[model samples]
Target chain A: MLHEPASQSGPDASADYKMRIGVWMFLLYAAIYAAFVAINLLKPLWMEKTVFLGLNLAVVFGFGLIVFALIEALIYNHMCGTHEADNKGGE
Target chain B: MAIAIFLTFVAAVLGLSFYFAAKTKSASGYFAAGGQIHWGVNGIAFAGDYLSAASFLGICGMIATAGYDGFLYSIGYLAGWIVALFVVAEPMKRLGKYTFTDALDAKFNSRGIKLFAAISTLVVSVFYLIPQMVGAGVLVEPLLGIPHYAGVIMVGAIVITIVATAGMTSTTYVQFIKGAMLVVFSLIVTVAVLVRGLSTEPDQGGRVPFYKYATLEAKEVKGALVVNDYKVLTSVPAKAETYVKLEKGGVQTWWLRSDKDGKIALKETQYEVKKADGSKLVNGLPASKDNVLRQNGGLEAIKGKTGPEAATGKVGPFEFLSILSDPETRINTWKIVKLSDGEDKVVVYAPSVKPGNKMMRPGLKFKTEGTPIQKLDFLSLMLALFLGTAALPHILIRYYTVPSPACARKSTIVAIAAIGFFYVLTMYMGLGAVINAALNPVTDNMSAPLLARTFGTFLFAVISAIAFATVLGTVSGLIIAASGAVAHDLMDRYLQLGHTEKQKVRAGKIAAFVVGIIAILLGILFQGMNVSFLVGLAFAVAASANLPSIIMILFWKKTTAKGIAASIVTGMVSAIGLIMFSPSMYDKFGLNPATAPVPLDNPGIISIPLSFLVLVAVSLLTQKKEASAA
Candidate 1:
């Protein structure tokens, strides 16, 4: 029933994942920050409503999910990938 | 590969338990890291312990469903931390042991102190524990597509195993992982929102429109409604539809669409007529009923609908706003419904813009746009949030995990950093769910997960697992508290079992299992209630019930054991009683909410002060304290 995998390197699993995740997250943060400031200043001469998965422009933006997703998909996945052997097998 | 990934995550955690369990050979190691964990690690564990199902699922769901008002909870939760920092954190570490009882009995060793403190911890922790287990049950359904009961059992078994095997050692690490992941990932989600930018639209990919027709119930009678929260006019087919009878001058017909790419097209038809003047009137209370106040629509627009289940009556317009802004009205919400179809339900919310305000969300509350009630609601909520943090039991216990009082202080700072950043993200997460318009109607608890789902199944899986882990981490901490009460406070301190350390550890493990079972039962009992709101109640109880005793004991040297006993019993009993007769509780049990006796959304404003008063008075009367008990 206990599902958390033991890291071969111990707490370093999360720490390592955290650092890598932090880097991508910060990158995503910077990109979003740049975009927010740019648009407010430049106000984009002719803005078109961009659709994502069918959602409107205003609804699509935020920092948490973007930074978080990169962390999970890129950072944790990479760090934990090599440790798949430790995961419950044939569940 | 999909199953593999899921299994891998689960197996990894279990393996860690085995590893930690191996290292956790002593009682101290199992219960508070033998007071030896790193400050940084303990800090994250604090986050893990604090950010339970209620914080992630309940608050996020409320925000997604309610709008700006929903975020008030997050504010209350974070604010509660300040109390922890200045009041409980340092001194608690200084006076501490395995449980809060030890601290109280430190100066005056009396049975009265032992008995009452044990009861208070058990009552509060049990009250708090139910939701975590129930949330766990609720969580597994979407993840494994399993039934709720099965999920509850699964979580119970797993938690028992983790606690039984490694006790506090593994629990601490689990919490740390969860707390860190939640903070970081939430930050990531916020960044995504900013980069993705705001949208005045809905996700069309898999969004469904079902509010085309909804049934409202009052006193067991049900009626069909043609609900349309239309911003622009669009005609709904009359072929099989019963038209809404519009008065001559109401806010005549408006269109309701889930923004630009709405899957379900909705419209509203209002015609508020004037007597050559402007006013509203309904059956009598004012034919001017604003869309008649959707019980579910107060925050944003979706989940606030009122019915037997949460999403039934569109809960009329201005319902929650009335609760939030008004002092007399306690929201009596209904339990969740199965909906004949059995596909489960979702709520779709849309945010509105009102100028010159600290926050935004439209059609939510009249007070929002410069109303006196709105200001009061904001103040009440803000006051509670700021003072409520440190009073929480789960949050309090994290302090003892660190090696020294110095580390405990440093850990709080780290927690503030992590927790603060996450709270900032909750705003975007809530708003993201709203504009995305791809939200679950029945269980507002599903907001964040549903939001992740809008992005893709992979994100959904990851978020769900993380959220599940969140439930595990928080529930584990809460259960630990309960078990400590049983083993450390009741068994040893009160009952004087005098069992060796191994036996004490075993008793705690057994107690954990019992508490876990109780939590599952409570989760099922309070099915429809939002986890976070309930958690807020828990915090209110903790603050009211435990905080006074702790504070008074720490400062007042003349404190008598009887005084502490009286304060704890009074706080627990009063809070539970107030909650029982609360409009929210009455409504959930399918009773007329009008019968409720309490007058406030939170009892802390009154209860906290009452507890303090009781403690002081009793202390004064029972002075020269210890001898009387003998």
Candidate 2:
């Protein structure tokens, strides 16, 4: 027997669309994150090179990834929200 | 005053838990907070739950001691939330009822899936709990002046009460409070750091100023170097680069050999030794106030600035990083050398001067130019942190507390933003500790708290209480997850014990009590082990055992029950097995690390991929059999 969901809410009508957007976003972020590890591994000295505001590539890139994730999350939420609103009535 | 504040915080948390207990009558209320938590509250709570003692204390301590290498953890950890927000959050909300096992086994009611997933949850939770519990004990001794075991028991009992009384409801609120307080107070500390700016001589609150090394001309008489009428007992031939050990007045200390303009000079170092007789000696003298390793860490000079009182007072965030990146600026960092002096253990806290440009870069703790295996170890750790956050049982279970998939997604975004902001502040807090003479030579875990003490006693008390709350929040969340695995997944579903709602809630409470006790014992048993290392192991285990099955099941249509079950077992066993014999564990076991079979300390690089391959193979093999049966 299939176990029921804990919440009483019905199945989401926009789940497929949301999943499509989510997968794309996941791939994009994973690539960016992978490049960070790759750069540290392959070109270690490159991190020491001064980049922005007298900070090295290591500090700048590290801070950039964190900020980028937040901006991407907000954008993802907004895109999904707009799509859900345009297609199905907002949840 | 700190004790009073801590007691007040504890009382407030207990009161909140008992208040929620009256409303948490059913199993749903106990397990998932009745799916009624507001997205905003749940979002902050997620941050609180996720930022355990490891993130707040361990990472800050690492950065304080090791520089930019520690921030790698903050980056990797926050990166993992991208996976949570974009992939796991919504589906988890839609599928899972109580625990992570609920989501994994939802598609297939196979007893194998239930049993294995529950086991994985419990294993991951228990491993994760050990570090947080140990960190609690570690924090308490310095902050509250209590014994370590007593601190561990106090945290265990309080967390058990919080979980058993109201389960997710109380845990969520506790996490929410902690998360908010942690962020706000860290921001205050960061602002304090920025306002104070860079200083060559930081005020040390009337304590003895940092020990300055004495430079003396190297004079050798009768094959022994003598300084201040004291005989050097062991001289290693004043080479251009080597430290020489000397004894005077029953105290032994190391002196650096420096050759400048064809003139040799010897510089004194601070060293501590623990003798076989259980007596401690500092600077070759019996441990006393007059002779000890003075507070370490400060800037030797600032760029384009002159004089001993040179300071970059009140700089912006960008300027702070910029000033530290100057080529002429030098920061004092301590390097610890552990050696055996006969039957006694000698630990030398040697001061090393590094250019600010190099200090802010990688290679302090994780050597980029190290061996290929060492490089791979860094990769494995990054991969684990990148993939581990979404797979963690306590984190996954939070998705169910929200009402809808959208709420789950929104809450995750909120978590990412709040946690990211706090992580950004960790850089400042760590750098603050590094340049402000705030590090405790004994433990790096106390760096953040000690940095707060540099600001004032009030901020220190508040930060310590919040850090303690951080441990309590995370431990309660882990216990709730583990309890749900046992009471809801194992007992009710896998074994089909057919417990009523009340019985199920009671069982969960009992499980929480037992797990809390186990955590306490492990915490006390594993004292002095690296907290960050234990946390990294948890991340590796979670990423290995859970992520493969989770991603495959959600994305792949051909995933079979056998695939999920086999994948979970393979991933869990492989990760645990590798860790058991890994070089780090070998060192922990008091054996030579080089003799260990596993080269990689983190199992995620190998075991995660292995799990995915096993799942695909098992699924392909069982597809035809399952098709025929259906």
Candidate 3:
């Protein structure tokens, strides 16, 4: 009962689909973050320059990352929920 | 009043623990809280468990001391949870029964998997526990007038009782309550900071003059340190010769010293006041009680002194940052310097006056522009903080508390929302501590609580108690993870002891007590170290040892049991081995830190990739054994 083998045709297919979406999100997020870090390492002085209204580049970019994470989470959650809903209807 | 409030909070948590003890009759109830926590509640509990003293005390202290750089930790920590949500959450919930090891061993019933995974959990948990225990010790001295060790032992006893009796059920509620209270109180403080705005002079005291020259007139009399003369620019403040300003090159500054680094350094000048009873009072205060070098406290000048907006009496949130960013602002802050000349070593408590523009930039600490090693150290620290969140054993186990995979995912999003908001509030709190002019000279961890004291004793008491609760909640979660690894994974699963559910629960309780004792001892031993640095080391170890294996098993189709086990051992050993001989460790041991074999303080840059390579190579070699579906 503990080790129920994941069925291939029913819920497994949905799980597989969700996994692919998860991978895609992870990659996109990682790429964007890597760019932010690269800027920090290579040209840290650039980050000190003011970009927004009175705020510097580092503050703007840092807050931007938080806002970016929130958006990604909401999007992924909605997509996965929709996927689950569609699969349930198919059943 | 503070002591009464502290005792009340402690009693409420203990009462909650005993009440939940009745509900835990089986291993499931003790280990995973019966898998019945509401997703909303469990989500916030995740925030409660994750914040620790590091976020509340350490990050704020760093910000109070280092400015914008401290908030970087907040950003890095919160960003790492995205990996937890996107990659680890659903699969972890779907596979694991009680502990993180349960998920790793799901694909293969390999003893090697359980053994190594359990060991990794213990190593990471213990490393994480030291900081929380140390923070507990720090709180005890100021709040209850007890020695550091007594506070550590008190927390150890309380946490062990909570874990032994109710287990995860009690721990979860403690975390939930602590998390909610921390966020609410932090919000209240942030609003207060904005309302009070920025000021050059403290409301309580008159301004002190800034000097430019300081000469520590001391000569070696035989083998003892003797004072010949101590003179500099002086206004003759009430208590004699304890402080002096510098006036170098016609620029009146805050400090003066003989070191090559001519930058302003404040020294807590101590004068010997020998009493008839053989007791000593250095500078009007007893040398024995909490007098770790003293710094002057009154504020000197405001940012805009004579303009239309002079003093800025009270400003809004954005206006606060602008005021701190102004070049005209001067702030008094501590700069610790360890001066060792041959057999005689003197620790100088150097204070400095710095401008707002310099404080709002990076490179005060973690010099990104120094040497190649320093820059690499900064990047490596960021990498570990970003990747370590998903790999932490205690965090991974939280997934099992939820019923379904969807609940697990939703809970993670909820956690992100709450944690993100709290982190944004840390910037204001940390800067507010500086602007409030109540920083604890010796330790930055006391920044938030000391800032609260400026408001009133009630706010101060509440903030301090909540900080202690933060320590308790985190330590309990860590102990639960450690206990699960011992009883469920090591004993029942790996050793094939075949214990009944009741016996397994009993074994877990015993393991919790043992682990709590070990944590208390280590915490006391590693006193005076910053909580954030200790936490950074924990994150590095977790990232190196556990992250690569977890990532590979979930994504790579060719991953075998042997590969996973080898990676865990390699990652754990290499990271810890390097850290054991790291420069920081050498410094901690009172040896020449430059003589350390490993140059880098953080091992994630080296060990993380090495772990991945070992996993891939081992997986290829063991390909003929079995192919687990990804």
Candidate 4:
């Protein structure tokens, strides 16, 4: 009962925030896929790994992601509104 | 030999389904453990559900045949969990409703967001399901001697029935059961490994090394290796193969079949003599392009060898055996040397899927030529595993099953412990399969079950059944996620199909059925690729498309719903589009990989960051636009 339908929520409910967000995300996405295809073609130095597990010192290194995923979660709760949507359920 | 026991497993799973059928009257009960699972129980269940046919069967099979490189995969997979616990676990709980899309639409209420998220979920889910279904198909063929397709159908039907009958509730509990059993039984097998220990020598009457790659007279085609050429390679070990001995040409040869059929058999084939120092050959040029090289990945292959060279690859006391199964480097592999009648020598390259690689895909792909398939494979897997875990709709829903965020967090902690422990045991089982020489050759997915068979039929039955349950639990979870997209995201969110709670639940059930069908078809389409690798792709898409939007919305005030919507749509679309055009799918769809649209097989290395950057840039530019309108 708390969250109403889009048409029902008030003038603010129809906010184009959704579309705006979608477009931004899509651009970044397009860019990333492009880069991936490019890397395969280029065969950059970092992508070269003589090691056993196929890990590389690539431009798109996995070590950074491992660090980032952990950091993003702990330091920030995805920056969710502790003020507005504070009604989160507890375990 | 294990057909009766396999039948028993199928029966047991079906029996369990009948028991839970009545309780699954509602969609909620079927999909999310009735939102009543305890954090601890669900935690273990999560671990169970996550380990699939790939982990149990593939890794052990790879290690048994391939060597040290096979074990490296296990380490990479286990390492990925650390990323999940610290970064993804808590935030994912906060995102979405029954699907990853729900959380995305919270801020924007955008149809674009809903559509894209649903599409992405379907794409990743279908890709992931293929391996599971294919593995099932592969398993039935050997254990039951049934056709591959029959096995696929059996598993697909059983999984569909399970999801249709018990929904999330049964799935969760079943996962817990499978996870616990997989770990415990594997421990028993590992003990068997230590007890029996490595044989002092190969062909010691009954026992042998994990694998025996042989060719009575192997022939080398362009991409194919044949039997005739194997004879020449083995016949003249006195030739250049044995001549240029800088350190005894590092080659492993076994005597199995001289011909395609067992009609022509040889008792032995000479392998390149392996001294202690020679076991360290990590990389080298193809010895001869025409030499026919064969590998025996499973124990069955060893028992069924048809030639003398079949045992040539077998190394002494501990030099080859010890180095072969190490997880760090893939040294001491059975190199294929294909010999032709007169053309050129050809070598068939066979990679050893390490336990970690089989456990989870490595996150390494940069779209480059210098990059070996292994590096590309490693990156692709890591990308998917890291990103996919949090974005899973079923996993997210598990948080809501608990009483509070604290419970969600606690459940994740428990899950980490259990999953971590289980992954550890998988390594032991993988190594055990090597020494026991009871590994499955072609499909690494059958490693764990075959390893169990080496001990006794009863153990094999239990292990195989647990693996089946593992499939049941995961497939059920995926179907629930897909259904949620249909019912909640597409129907309710997009169409504005207002309905009562009862109606909503019913809609979900129907959606589950449809998704189940879709999963079955996809499972059949992409059969050859490993399941863990497929799952890794799923992870990459989920992480790229869904995770970024959710994280940005929760944390950034500048994030208007518009930014959130855009990011989710982009991430989902781009990742899916890329995967569809990828070489992996192209071959499946009967298209040439060279002609395929997407250049790189994996999209994560680029797609993930693109998501984050878009959110930040758009949020900055459009901050005032939303404020004035409000």
Q: lDDT (0-100) at residue B478 of candidate 3?
A: 99
User: What stretches of model 1 exceed 4 Å from their correct place?
Assistant: A1-91, B1-4, B204-384, B624-630
Evaluated at residue B465, the lDDT of candidate 2 is 98
Looking at model 3 chain B, report the run of 10 residues with the lowest lDDT sum: B204-213
State the displacement of the C-alpha of residue B26, model 1, in Å, after optimal TM-score superposition.
2.3
**RMSD in angstroms between candidate 2 and the native structure over all alpha carbons:** 2.3
| lDDT for each residue of candidate 3 in B383-424, tens digit (9 for 90 to 100) | 888899999999988887777788889989988888988998
Q: TM-score per candidate, in order?
A: 0.68, 0.96, 0.89, 0.68
Model 1 Cα lDDT, one tens digit per residue, B1-630: 334555666677778788988787655666676778888888788888887788888877776655545655665565455456545665667666666776677777778877887777777777777777668777778677788888878877777777878888888988888788788777766555444432222332334322322222211114223333322222332323322322223443322233234233333322222232344322112453243322121222223323323322222112322222222212212122111112312112222322211223222321333344334333434444545565566666666677655466567756766775676577667755654554554477877877766666776677777888887787788788788878877887778877887887889889998988887777666665678767777766777778888878766777778898898888878777777877678878788766767644556666777888999999888775455555
User: Candidate 3, chain A: TM-score?
Assistant: 0.83
Weakest ten-residue segment in model 4 chain B by summed lDDT: B239-248
Docking class of 3: acceptable
Q: Total clashes, candidate 1?
A: 102
**CA error at residue B480 for candidate 1, angstroms:** 1.0
Lowest summed-lDDT stretch of 10 residues in model 2 chain B? B232-241
lDDT of 4 at B285: 29
TM-score of 2: 0.96
Off by over 4 Å in 3: A1-13, B204-255, B258-310, B339-346, B627-630
Which should have the higher DockQ, number 2 or number 3?
A: 2
Error of 1 at B153 (Å): 1.8
What tens-digit string does per-residue lDDT give for candidate 3 at A5-82? Answer: 121112334688878888899888888777777776787777666676666677777777777888899999999999
Report the number of clashing residue pairs per model: 102, 2, 11, 125
- Chain B TM-scores per candidate, in order, are 0.76, 0.95, 0.88, 0.74
